[model samples]
Target: MTQENHQKKIITNEDLFDHISGFKLEVKKTVDDFKSEMKESTNDLSNSILRLESSVEDLRKSTLEGFDMVFKTIDDTNSELREELKNDNIILRKEMNQRFSVVDKRFTIIDDRLTVVDDRLSSIEDNMTYKHQLSPKFA
Candidate 1:
C-alpha cells in the first residue's frame, strides 16, 4: 500500500507539472500572436504613411508645374500685348504727324494771303494821300 501511494503521489506531481507547462505554452502563444498583430499593424501604418507622402509629393510637383504654366502663359500674353501697344503707338505717331503737316500747310497759305492784302491796302493809302494834296493845290 505504501508503494502504491508513492506511485500515486509521483503521478500527481507529473500531472501538475504538465498542467503548468500547458498554461505556460498557452501564455507564450498568446503573447506571440499579440506581437505578430502589432507588427502587422505597424507595417500597415508605415505603408500608409509612405503612400501619403508620395501622394503629397506628387501634388506638390503638379501644383508647381501648373503655376509654371500659368506664369509662362501670363508672360507670353504680356509680351504680345506690349508688342501690340508698341505698334499702335507707332501708328498713332504717324497719324498725328500727318495731321500736323496738313495744319502747317494751311497756316502757311493763310499767312501768304494776309500779306498780299496788307500790301494792296498800303498802296491805296499812298495814292489817296497824293490825290488829296493835289486837289487842295488846284482849288
Candidate 2:
C-alpha cells in the first residue's frame, strides 16, 4: 500500500512549470498579432496623406495659370486703347492747323484793301487846300 501511494503522489513542480510556459507562449502570439495590425493601419494612413498632398499641388498650379492668362489679356487691351488714342490726337491736331491757315489768308486780304482806301483819302485833302488859296479877295 505504501509503494502505490508514492507512485500516485509523483505529480510535482515540473508539471506546473510546463503549464505556465504554454500560457506565456499564447500571450506572446496575441501581442505580435496586435503589432502587425497597427503597422497595416499606419501604412494606409500614409498613402491617403500622400494622395491629398498631390491633389493640392495640382490645384495650386492650375490657379496660377488662370491668373497669368487674365493678366496677359488685360495688358493687350491696354496697349490697343493707347494706340487708338494716339491716332485720334494726331488727326485732331492736323485739322486745327488747316483751319488756322485759312483764317490767316482772309486777314491778309482785308489788310491790303485798307491800305488802298488810306491813299485815296490823302489826295482829296490836298485838292481842297489848293482851291481855298486861289479864291478872290473880299471887298
Candidate 3:
C-alpha cells in the first residue's frame, strides 16, 4: 500500500506539469492576438488622420483662391474709377479754358468803348472852358 501511494503521487505531479504547459501555450496565443488587434487599430487611426489632414489642406487652398479673386476684382474696379475721374477732370478744365477765352474777348471790347467815351468828354470840357472865358489867358 505505501508503494502504491508513492506511484499515485508521482502521476499527480506529472499531470500538474502537463496542465501548466497547456496554460502557458494559451497565454502566448492570447498575447499574440492582442498585439495584432492593437497594431490594426493604430494603422486605421493613422489612415484616418492622413485623410482629415488632406481635406483640411484642400479647403485652405480653395479659401485662399476665393480671397485672391475678390481682391483682384476690387483692384480692377478701383482702377477703372480712377481713370474715369481723370477723364472728367480733363474735360472740365478744357471747358473752363474756353469760357475764360470768351470772357477775355468781351472785356477787351468794353475797354475800347470806354476809351472813346473818355476822348469825347475831354473835347466837351475844352469847348465849355473857351466859351465861358474861364482860362488864365482870358483873365
Each prediction's TM-score versus the true structure: 0.77, 0.55, 0.62
What is the Cα-based lDDT of residue 126 in candidate 2?
70
**Could you tell which candidate, 2 or 3, scores higher by TM-score?**
3
lDDT of each: 0.94, 0.82, 0.89
Best by TM-score: 1
- In the predicted model 3, the residue pairs found to clash are none
39-114 in candidate 1: lDDT tens per residue? Answer: 9999999999999999999999999999999999999999999999999999999999999999999999999988
> Deviation in angstroms for 66 in model 1?
1.2
Residues 39-127, candidate 3, lDDT per residue (tens digit)? 89999999999999999999999999999999999999999999999999999999999999989988988888888888888889888
Give the candidate number with the greatest lDDT: 1
> What is candidate 1's CA lDDT for residue 104?
92
Question: If both were scored by TM-score, which would come out higher, candidate 1 or candidate 2?
Answer: 1
Ranking by lDDT: 1, 3, 2
lDDT of 2 by residue, 33-109 (tens): 88888888889889988988998998999889989989999999989988998998898889888888888777887
Please list all clashing residue pairs in model 2, or write none if there are none: none
Off by over 4 Å in 2: 1-37, 109-139
